[model samples]
Target chain A: MKTRYSFGGDEHVYVEIDEEMSLEAFFIALSLRNAVAEAEIPGVTEICPANASFEVRFDPDVIAPEEIMARIRELEHKAEVSDKRLETRIIEIPVYFQDPWTHETLMRFRERHQDPTGSDLDYAARINGYDSVEAFLEAFHSQPWFVSMVGFVAGLPFLYQLVEREKQIQVPKYLRPRTDTPKLSVGIGGCFGCIYSVRGAGGYQLFGITPMPIYDPTQTVSYLKDFMVFFRPGDIVKWKPVDRAEYERIEAAVAAGTYTPRIAPVTFDLDAFNADIAGTNANLMEALNGI
Target chain B: MAFKVVKPGLSTTVQDLGRPGYFHLGIPEGGAMDRFALRVANMLVGNDEGAAGLEAVFMGPELTFDADTLVAVTGAEMPIFVDGEPREGWSAFVVKAGQTLRFGFLKAGARIYIAFGGGIATPLALGSRSTYPIGALGGIDGRAIAAGDVVPVGEATTMTERSLDRSLLVPVSAPVSLRVLTGLYWHRLTPACQARFFADEWVVAPEADRMGYRFRGGSPMEFVDREQPFGAGSDPSNIVDGCYSYGSIQVPGGQEPIVLHRDAVSGGGYFTLGAVISADMDLIGQLQPNTKVRFTEVTMEEALAARAARRDRLAKLRAALA
Candidate 1:
C-alpha cells in the first residue's frame, strides 16, 4: 500500500495508509500506530489511529516536524513487514432492535433520510437485498466486527465487518445531519456500524438502541470501574439481539452496578482469518458462546 | 479560598492548557479557546502558565471573592469593574473580600480569560481542569459555571502584580486573514474551487464555539467528480469516516466551511480540505460573530516558520512578565 504523509498543521502529521477503507488498510495503519506507540518517541503527545489513516500530534518545541515525519516514515516501513496478530477481546453487546426510543428519534428526522416513509431498518434491509428486517439482523449478527476506530465521541466504537469486501454492507449517510440522536443508538453510516455514545447531532441511520452503557465519566458500572471509556480500537464486537424485557433487565442491572459486559479474550491472526474467513469467524463466534 | 458566582455569564467554564493524550479516546484537548490570553492572565496573577482560569464567552460573570486576592482579566476589550470601580485589563490587581468583580458589555473580541491569584481549584477529571462539556469531564462537575456556584481557588504560593506590554497582547481586528496549510483530501476539490476558496472572503457564523468555527459567505466549493468509494457517503464532499485534525477545515456539501477547534470530535465522515495552522488558532478563538475573515494558503515550510515566530513571541512575552 502507498502511504501518503501530509501535514495537518505545524503540530500534527497525518498519515493516510490507503485511499479507501479496508481491513488491509486498517491493519497497516494499526501496525504503524502500534509501532509508534511502542517506540515511545519523545514529544509525541497523541497517536490517533483511524479507519485507514492515523494522525500524530506532537510538541514541535521538543521535536521538529520534519524529524517526526522522518521517524514515522521509518516506523511505517517496519510496521508493514511486522506480525499482524492482534490479541484483543470479543465483547457481546446486547441490543434492543427497533426500540421505541431510537424509532421515535429516527421518525422525527425522516426528512433527512433517503426513504422518509419507511423505517431505517426497512430501508437498510431493502437496499442490502434482504427480504425482511429479520434477515438483515441475522446477517448483521452472524459475523463479528472489528473496531476499526474509536472516536466521534467518547468510547464510541466504529466497526467494520470482518467478512470479505464483497459481503460488506454499504449504506449512505443522511443527506443532512439531524440535531438529535438517542444515546446508545446503534447506527450505521456507510459501511461502519457505531453505537452513539452520547445524545447529540448525528447523521447515521439508526437501527436500535443498546442497553449497555459503553461510556460513563463516572465509572458506575462494574466492568467500567477500571476505565470510564469502555471501547478501544482493535476490540471485536458481536451483536446479541434481545427483547424489550431483556433489555430492561440489563438496564436495571446496569443501574444497580451489577452488570458486567460479556467479554471473551481472543488472539486474532490476520493471515489465518484471510485464509479461511468462514471457519475463522465460526471459531470466533464459538469462543464467544463458550464464554 | 472560594468565590461565589453572583451571576454566571453566558457560557463560563474553568480552563487551563488542556488535557492531552485523550484524543484517541474521542476526548478533545479542550481548554480556553484563547490559550495565549489565558497564559497571559495566569502569568499576570503569578500562577503557572497552565493554571486553571475562568473562560467567559461573549459576557462576563459577576463574581464575589470571599478573600482578598489578586486577579487579572485578559482577552476581549471588556471593561473590568471591581465593586463598581473600573480596573485596567491585562494587568493584575487586588480584589478585597466582599467586593464583586463584574464587566460591561464586550467592546471587542469574543472570550475573556479571568485568572485568580491562585488558579481555580476544581477537581481534575483527567489531569486538567479544562472542561470538555460534551464528554462531561473536568471543570466544575463537567459543565459550565452557573449562578450560586462557589468555585474553589488554589493557594497562591507567590502573589505578584504584572502588566503585559501592548505588543505582547493578541491582536484582533475585523476581516482577519487566517493562514491555512491545505492538505488531506485537498485533491478532492476541483482546481476552480480551490482557487475560489482562497479568493473569496468569509464571515464567522453564529455557530462558532469551542468545538468549531463555521465560516460563511465564501463561494461554494466544488469537488472533483469521482465514483463514490464503498462506505463513503454520496456527497461529493464526503469521505469515509476518518480522523479530524485540530484546526482541520471541513465543508459539508461544499459550503459553509467549518474549522475544527480545541474541542473537536476526533473522527467523522466529512472530508477536510486542510487545517488552519496552530499559530492562527488563537486568533480564531478571539473572533466575534460576523467577523470577516479570509483564508490564505501557505506551504508547510511557511507554516512552520510562522509557528516558530509565534513561539519566539510567546517567549518574549514570558520574559517581559518575568
Candidate 2:
C-alpha cells in the first residue's frame, strides 16, 4: 500500500491508506486504527478511521506532530491486516423500499435533483444500465455491504457493497441539497449507501426508509443504552427488504422497546473474501441469523 | 438564581469547552466559538475555564436578573447597560436584583461571551453544556433560550468591578489574515489555484454560521483532471468520503471556500485545500460578514509557535488577575 501521510495543521495527522476505496484498503485502515487505539499514545485526542484512510487528532503541546506521525507510521508497519482475523458484527437492517415519507421528500426536492421529472430510483436504475427499478433493487440487495465509514451526520453509515469495483453501484448527488429529509431515510450518493440519522438537510438520492432508529438521543433502544449511535466503521450491514405489514410490525416493536437489530459475530478474512466472493457471502448470510 | 429573557438576540446559546472524543460518532465539538473569551469571562466570575456561559452572536441578549449576581462580558465590543446606565466591555460588574441588563449595537467582532458568576447551569449532555443547535443536543432544551425563558445561574461570590487589559482582546477588523497549513488534498489541485488561493482577498459570505463560514471572491480552483475513482464523485472537487478535521477548508464547485467550524459534521467527501491553524481558530468567530480574509500559508512549526505564544499570553493574564 502506497500510503500518503500529511498534516491537517499542527493538531491532526491524516494518512491516506489508499488513493481509491476498496475493502482491502478498508481492512488495512481498520487494523491500523485498532492498533493505534490499543497503543493509547498520550496527547492523541481522537482516532477516526474512514473508508480508505484514517486521521488522528492530537495535542502538539504534549507531543510533537512529527513524533505522533512517526508513531502512526510504525503502527501501520506492524498492523498485519492480511493475517489477523478481523472481528466484525453482521447487522440485519430492514428497509421499506420507496416508503411514503422518503418518496414524498424526494418528490419535494425534485428541482434540486439531476432528473427533475423522474423519481430518484428510476433515474438511478436508468443510469446504472438496469432495465427496470426491480432489477436495480435486486442488484442492490444481492450482497451485503461493508460499513466503511460512519459519518457526515451522527449515526450515518457509509456502506460500500462487498463486491469488486466493476460490480459496485454508482450515482451522483443532487445538484443542490434539499432543505429537509425524513428521519431514517435510506439514501445513496455516488458509490456509497447511507441512512439519514436525523431530519435536516440532505443531498443523497433517497430510496427508502428504515423503521429501526440508528440514532437515539434519549437512549431508548436497549443496544443504544451506552451510546446513541449503533453502527461503527468496520461493521457489516445487510438490508432486508420489508413489506408494509412487516415495516409497521417493526415500527410497533421499536415503539414498544422490544426490538433490536439482528447481529452475529463474524471474522472478516480479506484474503479469503477476495479469493471466493460468493462463498464468503454465503458464510456471512449463514452467520447472521438472530438478535 | 435566574434571569428572565427580555429579548433574545440574533442567536444566543449556552456554551462551554465542548465534548471532545465523539467525532468518530459524527458528533461535533459544538462549544464556544471564541473559547479564549469564554475562558476569560468564566475566570472573571471565579469559575473554571470550562464552565458553561452564554454565547451571543451579532447582537446581545437583554435580561433582568431575579437575584443579585456577578457577571462578565468578553469578546465582541457590545455596549452593555445596567438599569439603562452604559458600562464598558471586557469587564465584570454586579447587577442588582430586578435590574435589567440591556445590550446596544456591536461595534466590532461577530460573537460575544457573557459569564454569570456561578455559570449557566444548563443540563450536561455527553459531558458538556455546549449546544449543537442543528442536532438539538446540549444547552437549554437543546436550543437557544427564547423570550420568557428563565435560565438558572449558579451560586457565586460577588466582587468589585474588573476590566481586562487591552492587549488580551482580539481586534475585529477587515482584511483579517488567517494562518493556514496546506491540506491533505492540496497536491491534487493545479498550481495556479494554490497561488491564487493566497493572492486573492476572500470575503465572508452572508451564510456564514457556526457550522462553517463560506468565503467568496477567491479564484475558482481547478483539480488535476483525472479519471474519477469509484466512490469519488465526478466533480473536480470531489474525493472518496473521509473524516474532516475541524477548521478544514473545503471548496465545493471551486466557488465559495467553506471552512468548517466547531459545530460541524465530523466528516464529508469534499476536497480540502487547507486548515486554519489552532491559534487562529478562535479568531474565526470574530470575523463578521463582508470581512476580508487572506489565507496565509504557514508551516507546522510556525503554527505551534503561535499556539505557544497565545498560551503564554493567557497564563500572564491569569497571573495578573491573581
Candidate 3:
C-alpha cells in the first residue's frame, strides 16, 4: 500500500499506511518503527506505533522536519523486505463478563449509547447477528487477539482479533463519550478491544471487567514487577471468561500481591499466519494451554 | 533544604522538561505546561534549565522554607509575598529560614512556575521528575502537592539572584492567536467547516487541564460525509484509532475542539485536524478560562520560521540573564 506522510506541526511526522485497519497495515507500521529506531537517527525523540499508522516526534532544531521525513521514507523502503517474524508472548487475561461494576457504569451512560433499552453486550450481540449474548461471548473468547497497539492511555492495549476480516466482530463507539469508565473495564469499539488502564472518561462499549492488573506504575503486582506495563505491541492476548466467584477470588489474590499472569513465549510469522489463519491460531493457543 | 507546604494551591506538581520516549507505552511527555516560564524561572535561580520546579495553576502555594534559599517565580502575573512583605515576580529573591512565601490572586495567566536555587529534589520516574498523575508516575508520590507536604529541595548549587528585564517577558494578553499547521486528518472536514475553524473565535473551556484544553463558543464544524472505514466508529468525526501528536487539535462531533497538551493521551479514535505549533504551546498553557483565542493556519515553512524565531528569543533571554 502507498503510505501518506504528513507533518504534525513542526515536531512530528505522521505516516498513515492505510485508511482502514488491518494486520498487514499494523505490521508495516511496526516494521517502519523498528527500522527508524535501528537507524539511530538523531533528533528523533519518540516512535509511536499505532493500529494502521505510526508517528515520529523529532527535534526540529537538531534535524529539519523535511530531513527526518526524507530519512523515514528511505527507511520505509528498506523495511518492505525486512523479516516479518515477531518473537512475542501470549498472555491469558481473566475477565468476568456481565460483571456488576461495568454493568452499572454502562447503565449510567445509556443516554449516550445507540440502544438505551438494552445492555452493551446485548446491543452488540444483536447488531452482530448473534441469537444470544452467550453465543457472542463464546465467539469472543474462542479466538485470541493481537495487541496491535498499546496506547490511548498509559498501558492500555488496543487488541485486534486473530480471525479474518469477514469473521471480525465490530461495534461503534458511544454516540458521545461517557464521562466515566470504571478502571479495568473490558470494552470494544469498532474492530478493537481494550481494557481501561485507569478510571477516566471513555467512549468504548463496556462488556466485562478484567481482574488482572494490566498496568501498575508502582510495580506492586507480581506479574508486572519487571515492567509497569504488562502488554506490549506484539503481545497476544487470550480472553478467558470466568464466573463472578472466580473474579472475586482472583481480585483478592491480586490485592494480596499473589497473582501471576499466565504467559508463554511464541513466534508469530506473518506469512504463515496469513496462509492459514485458523490453523495458526490453534497452534498459538496450544502453546498457551501448554504453559 | 526543604519547604513545608502550609497550603497547596489549586493543583501544584513537580515538573522539569518531562520524560520523553514513552509515548508509545501511552505515557505522555508530561512537564510544566508553560515550559518557557519554567526554564526562565530555573535560569533566574541558577539551576539547570530542565531542573524540577513547582508548577501551580490558578493560585500559588503557601510554602515555608526550612533553610535560606534563592527562589524565583514566573509564568503568571501575581503578587509574591515573603513573610507578609510583597516581593516580585520574574526575579530571584532570598527566602530565609522560617519565612513563608505566598501569593495574591492571579492577575494574569493561568499557571505559575516556582524554581528554587537547586531545584526541587523529587525522585525521578522514567528519568523525570515531571508528574503524570493519570499514570501515577513521578513527582511527590506520583501526585500533586497537598497541605502539610514537606517538599524536598536539592542543595543550593548557586546563590546568585538574577532577573529578566520586563521587556524580555512574553506578555499574556487577550485574543491570543495560536498558529496551527493543519495535517493528520484535515481532509476529513468540509471546506466551509475548514474555513469556519480559522475564522471563528474560540473561548477556553473550563474543562481545560494538563491533558488537553477544550475551546468552545465557535460554530460547530461539519464533516464531509463518507463511507465509514472498517473498525472506525459511525460518527463523522471518528477515525480508526491513531496516534495523537503533542498540540494536536481534535474536534469530536465537530463541537468543542480540544487541543491535546503535555499530558495528552498518546492515541485515540477522534480525528485531529491539525496541531498547534510548538512555539505557541507555552502561550496556551498560560491562558485562563474564558480567554478568547483564534486558530490561525500557517504553512510548514511559516511554522518552521516561527519555531526558529522562538528559539532565538529563548537564546536572547538566556544571554540577557547571563
lDDT of each: 0.89, 0.87, 0.92
Residue pairs clashing in model 1 are none
lDDT per residue for candidate 2 within A1-291, as digits (tens), equals 779899988899998888778887787888888888889999999988898888999999999998999999998876654454568889889999988888998899899998999999999999999999999998888799988898787778999998777878899988887989999988888899999998898888989989999888768777788988898877888899998999999999989888878989988788898899889988898887543
Ranking by DockQ: 3, 2, 1
lDDT of 1: 0.89
- Ranked by TM-score, the better of candidates 1 and 2 is 1
The candidate that achieves the highest DockQ relative to the unseen native structure: 3
Q: Which 10 consecutive positions of candidate 1 chain B have the poorest summed lDDT?
A: B166-175
TM-score of each: 0.97, 0.97, 0.98
The C-alpha stretches of model 3 lying farther than 4 A from their native spots are none
Q: List, residue by residue over A1-291, the lDDT tens digit for candidate 1.
A: 879998787888889888788888888999999899899899998999999899999888798889999999989778898887889989999989989999999899889989999998999999999999999989887799999999987878999998998888877888889999988999888899999998898988888889998888877678887888989888999999999999999999999988878888998888999999999888888888786
Error at A179, model 1, angstroms: 1.2
RMSD, each candidate, Å? 1.4, 1.7, 1.4
What is the TM-score of each candidate's chain B when compared with the real chain B?
A: 0.98, 0.98, 0.98
Off by over 4 Å in 1: B158-162
Q: Best-fitting candidate, measured by lDDT?
A: 3
Q: Tens digit of lDDT per residue, candidate 3, span B1-322?
A: 8999999999999999999989999999999999999999999998999999999999999999999999999999899999999988999999999999999999989999999998999888899999888988999988999999998999877777666799976665568999999999999989998999999999999999999999999999788889988887788888889999999999988799999999999998989999999998999899899999999999888988988888888899999887
Q: Once model 2 is optimally superposed onto the true structure by TM-score, how far is the C-alpha of residue B125 displaced, in angstroms?
A: 1.1
